[model samples]
Target: MNETIQTILNRRSIRAYESRQIDEHELQEILLAGEYAPTAMGQQPWHFTVLQNPDLIEKLQTLCKASFLNSDNASLREIATREDFQVFYNAPTLVIISGNSKAIAPLQDCVLSMANMLLAATSLGIGSCWVHSPMMVYGSADGAASLSNIGIDFPKGYEPYAAAVFGYSAQPLPKAGPRNSDTVTMIR
Candidate 1:
């Protein structure tokens, strides 16, 4: 079996992160992998905003908190409050995926791209968490304006699709859950 394939199967999401930052070269490669993910209609309309500055990352987290507090969506806001209203998990790096809304496909396309980056980071001995909550801000006045304040801009229809935090693990990660047979099928 190919090593890359093995890495893919072995990777898992890591929640707790060390304070150390990732190497620049590794970060670049991870983003490069995201850029290479297949996009619908070959329209690679997504932009990746990599966050390395600690101060800036904190600001983004603050904005995320404010957005969650102001979200009209009841279920999400209730759950966020239960989680202590924290966002971004204080990881050393954040990658925000945004896309052109001229078409709706960009939303899913950008998500797949971010997913690729997450696996890539995990394979590189790093930890990653896919954050879907902050994305809600992209669709609102407070969140949209907040994103712009953090140097993330939209080209009219462009909006955030997803955000992920990555870094070295602070503790050992749990083994991946069993690949339950029910989730797979073989086509004759």
Candidate 2:
């Protein structure tokens, strides 16, 4: 199998991270990989915000943690507002993927790009994760001021799409398992 396919098959979402930061070049390359993802109508109407500032990263973490911790849902509150909860899972960098809220299908495009970036990061020996849980706040201005502080327009019209955290992993990478037969469909 080719390396790209291998990367995809082998990729696993990392939730834990070490204390070190990824190099600026690697971060740029990962975002570049995301940019290459195909978009509907070629709108490319998405914005990529990379968080490299440690202080900012910490502040955002606190905000995310607070948001989750304050939720009324007992289960959700258990995850988000818990004393031990860390919004970014303590990862060193955050890549916020957002797009024109008005785009015909912004969520689909954003997810595709995020998937591309995740695969790219895996191939490069960088730790990464999809972070499906945080999209709840990223699209909300009251929720995502951290993105705005970095100069990314938190579009009241721009829907927050998805997010991925990148860094060096603190543990062994997991192996990909076989796909369940029930999950696949082939049409000719």
**lDDT for each residue of candidate 1 in 56-137, tens digit (9 for 90 to 100):** 8777777766677787878667765775555666689988888887865988899889988988897888888888766866
Candidate 2 lDDT over 59-109, as tens digits, reads 666656665656666776777645677767778888888889788788889
Local distance difference test, each candidate: 0.81, 0.77
- Candidate 2, pairs of clashing residues: 68-81, 69-81
The lDDT, on a scale of 0 to 1, for candidate 1 is: 0.81
Against the hidden reference, what TM-scores do the models get?
0.84, 0.86
Native-referenced Cα lDDT, model 2? 0.77
| Model 1 regions more than 4 Å off | 72-85, 178-181, 184-187
